[model samples]
Target: MLESLLDGIFNGISIGSVLLLAALGLAIVFGLMGVINMAHGELMMLGAYTTFVVQNGFKALGAPWSDFYIFFALIAAFIVTALVGLLLERGVVRYLYGRPLETLLATWGVSLILQQFIRSVSWQFAAGVGVFCLLFFGALWLISRRPDFEQIRGKAIAIMLPLSGAISLVVSNLLGQTYKFAVTLPWFGTQGVDVTAPKWLRGGLPLGGYQLPYTRVFIIALTILCLFAVFWFLNRTVWGLRIRAVTQNRSMSACLGIPTQKVDALTFAIGSGLAGVAGCAVSLLGSVSSNTGQSYIVDTFMVVVIGGVGKLVGSIVAAATIGIISYVVGSNALAPLVEFSPFLQGLLEFFATASMAKVFVFALIVIFLQFRPAGLFPQKGRTVDA
Candidate 1:
């Protein structure tokens, strides 16, 4: 009985670790920045795909390297997603800072675009994106650095946008037939892919006469590392202080020459990158598809909301609470405790199934929210915009 209880608790914590990873980024971006970025899930999807690509690259190098691909994949996922997040912020989000509705609509569109792009990514498509980003970022750089270029910033973008498309068409026509990768008759990447864990993480770790899966143990350890990293980054670093200062008072931070815009951008990038790391961990559990991020996005959001907006500790507490409750109820671990009452046993049997467990958890969260609307830990001041 003790063994069963411990197993359930461990499983619950393992689940919560994933939630912590997913929600850590959301808490920073959504809770701190107040941007309704609907594309956050898509960013996680992109991270998973990035991992797939990295793993394949290692496999191409043969067997010895494939086992170590995860280290590289995690780094690549973080960098790729962070860059994408930076682009989203600069291109769409910056323009719609205070307009939550517009940001939501715009990011949702971006999410769809990203999903389709991955589903049918071609060499030609890759070439076109490269050309576009080159021209686009180059023009922006020139405008920022050169006084004369600033006058034609709008004109540069207007011309460069179409010019890049034209260049892509030319490149595709000339070199498309030779350069081929996922050149499918219809679709190659749509079926999704799975990432096998390394040999070291494949087995179980014996603890208290009960075995705990190494993957779950690794994930829990990873969560603790990430949590500490966040704390150290936010509290022990110079940039973290700047992020906090800018978040608290943008105008004051700007006046103090803190580069508020840059801080906001970096903060968003960090959050998105953390989401990407979450994707890497997720790949260990199941197949990664275009819809992978969508599976956990809702639960992640709930965790952040229940944890308290902009409160890291709250996110931690809330994730653990929700994870434990969901796992216990779903697995019927509490059955023994309620075995004395026949009516209660029947009720538990009905509602304690895996599918029905989430409904109960959601309902509990809603009821909790009714009593404490600000969440478990409320922000001290007016952090969110009206």
Candidate 2:
């Protein structure tokens, strides 16, 4: 009845929040850079693991202080993964620009390396080195502020490209020998370290004859916050202006002294950092593991593709559409409505299964793409050479 209907809608929105988070980064990177980062999910995995590390570290401090760790974990995840992304841009991705196929293969390799390293290495060691990378990059970022480095700034990426790769390998090996996939905390759970929502979010609120979980509300709120933040940063800031100019026309932007290379790197870093935050939020609902991020990769890409690649509004619409449709169909909440018709019942039964729902969703995306290959909100005007 009304309860089932309300529950279905809430579930759809909750799932949509996650989609918004995971797809936001993909949309930005793929839209602006024209580079499909297959390793984007790995960057998310890095963030989740970073959260786990922070959680465990906080656990040792006894009571009170440990309770507030999730807040810190989110920030840490963003900072750490952002640095990794900058190195990735400077080292491997920079050289492969304009070569989509090669970028795909190389990034896929990086993903594999990241996954294996997470499963086998010491996270603390890897994290320590990541901090060093952050410091090193911070120094470089400062140098970019000086007038003397303005001309040489573009060349810095080229000069540091090889070194970036070396640094990645070193960080991988520096990861400790043992791997702890999960954490154990008293408040979250007795057996494992779970991201327990705050007390206010531990209960449900009744609405329209159904009780909606506070966690879902929190997630939706977080997604909206992120969206607003991204919108403001892109529309209001100088860096955002540079990014938009480059996105419109890279060659012209460079001709106008826009420092296209820095924009590319900084933009990638921001996108990757957003993915890291997505991972941190995801950890609240599920177990954080090496393969956790891989699960969201395809769905995220679909959101970017179905929405126009470079269109923020398109990403939002596509993500909400896909999320609602997928959840409603998969959850079988519509089955009761069709119970009167035997044939329709059978069809609903078939599509009610999660796997079948995914097949249906993918099929729908393919059909949609066939009609609107440029997506729901394609960019207009002069096109850049991809």
User: lDDT of candidate 1?
Assistant: 0.84
In the order shown, the candidates' Cα RMSDs to the true structure are 2.6, 6.4
Task: Give the TM-score of each candidate.
Answer: 0.91, 0.81
For each candidate, the alpha-carbon lDDT, in order, equals: 0.84, 0.80
Tens-digit per-residue lDDT, 1-386, candidate 1? 88878878888888888899888888889888887777888888888878888988898999889888989988999999999999888878888888889988998899889888878766666666677677777767867787777678888788877887787667765556665543322233688788888778898988887788888888898889989999999999999999888777788788899987888899989989988888888888888888888788798889889998889999999999888888988888888998899998887787787779899999999999999898999998678542
Query: lDDT of model 1 at residue 103?
Result: 88
Give the per-residue lDDT of model 2 (tens digit) for 263-380. Answer: 9999999999988988888877877777877888998998888888788899899888888888889888888898889998888778887788888899999999999998999878
TM-score of candidate 1 relative to the true fold: 0.91
Error of 1 at 62 (Å): 3.6
Where is model 2 poorest over a 10-residue stretch in terms of lDDT?
182-191
- Provide the clashing-pair count of each candidate structure: 0, 5
